[model samples]
Target: MKMRKARTPIIGKLPLRKGTIGFRLFLYTEASKRSAEVKKYAKASRIIIYFIDRSPHLVTGNNIELISLQFLHRQSFTEKIEQLSEEYDILAIVGTVQFEYNDIPYFSLIDIFNDDHLKKLNSIICKDEPYSEMIQTLENHLTMVPSVSRLVQRLRKVIVNLELQLNVNLKEDIVIGMILHMAFLVENMKLQQPGRIFPNMEEYYNSHKEEIAKVKEVLKDIEIEYDIKLTDGEIAYICQMCLENQQL
Candidate 1:
């Protein structure tokens, strides 16, 4: 008798686009004069400069490619912050050297934007910041091995917890928000343990088979909501093998 196998369900692929990730740097300077020098070296595919003051605001154009040295230190940091309330296609934040202010640090705001741009924003911001090494380590973990199943499971848990804590229903925004938040959390985690050994693709999969299977189930339910269909059986096979290996 042929053994009946579970028919793997087909689901849609998660959308990923450039600029989905972003980094926000808070540089600490005695005054705008000293901060100007640091800003001069900043470069990326996209760039923005803002002063961190009572209210943050954008001082540079959205399309500018290179860091605007002229805009640096021209206005007080407080003035730049005022502009932060305005929305942009890309992520925005006041440039600063200090990571914290008055004993309060900025919480991870990765959930603020769409997925396609979020990753790109994270990469550009991290590369240009003083914490480049730290950021690099974080990136390494996030990019180490792509296990969509594990990623989906972990993300689901995070979004659920976030919803509970915030007392706000973010069901509509959970998927994209979770992806960005996971990237940031992973980055920050690696920064805390630069020498940490990130789980290998095989290892991660083997350890999380059950969780991954559940993710597959969820994906089937939400397949239509995504932009691409993920009907690849190979991916599911790999995830299963990883989980099986972990048990041995």
Candidate 2:
């Protein structure tokens, strides 16, 4: 039998132009902010790259370079944001730090990552592009990693049960986001490493006990099936995702 070489996984590739005649998006992250935002943007940036898929018309080349400034400089940066907005004809701002620009459209870090909300961003960036199809392609590329693909399938079942118990339908994007988070989380647990620690989780869990309990029940089977356990903080984070979906 002949041996076949394994193909490398597709991560994502950046576009080829600079601040040219196309939609410009500013990804802002503060130096003093939580590392989580930085990490989130890293994931988001990769997704954006997948979205572009080397298309020339989606986003300018410089879009990948994050804008990092100090918190104290925010007051002065308002004028700067306006300048960049005019200079680049920036269509939208997506970032961790909130900007005070009243004229420009701004989407928080969370908004750009979600499927339902990403549509809003898509409309702004490129209306002709098929949003759902692009997202599906993105998911397909991400799941090329064998572990992520397996975990995503398992997490989908857990999320479906969660929706039934909560009586709330999560959008495709939210479901995908939850699955990705859970997949990585389980991977972490399998390695005997602690996942993200939700700050003041005790108080948060106490206040939202009823909601968290439902999430716990839905997740119990998955934990046993995977032969791993979820930390309280991790469960609380999952509970928060459910609550957010409910609100939507």
Candidate 3:
């Protein structure tokens, strides 16, 4: 599908690309900043949800980077749709008002919660409803600054403590992924559960013992703050994130 001109109001009308990470839904709204509706879709889709202001033009600056870190594991670019709509490949514009254009789907907030609209949304994002348990956990952390920035600092601190260097892109991308991972870990701890067991964990642990030790040490602050112990599997998962982000 072809996109309208850059000057046009509606944007990101192109068809979904093969093997793309996921849709970047521009959720235009004049409501309160960080509404529950915005959080719901964002957590469900596990992708970037750019909250639009009253005007059609997009908001820019630090908020974009902050929000992007909140849902960064997918690696969605957070450029303003007005400037790079075509390249952004936005999935749709969902908001309280519906646009007249047919370039892309416009989902009204009124009917967005309806079963039919939700099914279409799922089809577009190529993911089923997020597990109910996980959604509850995400809602709890969605508004927490510590969940995004503090977790990022913890991971970056671990990298430095280990005397490792990571490229700029990987460093940013991995921090985003790690934030999401840690959120789930917190949830699991609340339920007296553990993260998924790593296969051949003994061998893997033997190979990366030093890295694992440092990761656990850095994560102690989070554990203390949340009053929850970190399971061995959780430590392994975090170690893998650090390793993947390391510049070899």
Candidate 4:
């Protein structure tokens, strides 16, 4: 799609492209002072967020880098559109009022600016109803701060695709729940949360060794890619989750 002029009260719509990321978020702001809370929502929602600059060529001056590495991410006017062109999709405006044109889910961001807003954002990001599509969304959307990255999200896509290719019969809810639990487990492990070890979990791990091993093998690349190790406990927990729900 070509770059078109953005009318007043409009965030520039991203050009439609092949393989655009699932969601793109634009934050309307005065000058360049954007709330840090917006970034949190972006990562959790796995949506790219742009701090719409007052000047066309303004650049963000902060250390929020890794999360903003993609298009619609904070950048100068010069590089922003180029990066946006490379990645993004149907532009949706989110703010304080419900001014929507066409079919975009426009909302007033001010209305949902608290924890409630984050919850709303998460729901929007995972709007796909089918289990398969939800799996894809979870893959793109799961982010637990400095712990999880695009690498982990990408791993979700690869794993889900491989499972389908292998003809693994799994329900949508199970996959969705599994992804949420697994992501939570990893995040908790990274934080060294209490009760990290499951009681008698070792026995379960031993009995399901083969299944656990397979998952570990499949996830070996994630370890390398993210430079993080899944502790035996975390692996055991995941194995228990995956094995209990299916005849793997």
User: Which candidate ranks first by TM-score, i.e. highest?
Assistant: 2
Taken over the whole model, the C-alpha lDDT of each candidate is: 0.33, 0.57, 0.47, 0.43
* Candidate 4 collision pairs: 95-108, 95-109, 96-108, 96-109, 97-108
Candidate 3 lDDT over 14-41, as tens digits, reads 4333433333445554322456756665
Instruction: State which candidate, 2 or 4, has the greater TM-score.
Output: 2
Model 3, runs deviating above 4 Å: 1-169
Cα lDDT tens digits for candidate 4, 1-248: 12233221222243333332334444332122355755554453332233223311111221111112222333453265345434443233454323322223343445334444333333333433454454455556555434243323443443443242233444446666766665655555446665357679768777877777766765665555444577777767666655456534
Candidate scoring better on TM-score of 3 and 4: 4
Clashing pairs in 2: none
Q: What is the TM-score of each predicted model, taking all chains together?
A: 0.20, 0.41, 0.37, 0.38
User: What TM-score would candidate 3 get against the native?
Assistant: 0.37
lDDT score, candidate 4, position 222: 51
For model 3 the local lDDT of residue 59 reads 24
Per-residue lDDT for 95-165 in model 2, tens only?
A: 66676353345566666566655554554444323433444554554532333433443465566556645
**How many clashes show up per model?**
42, 0, 0, 5
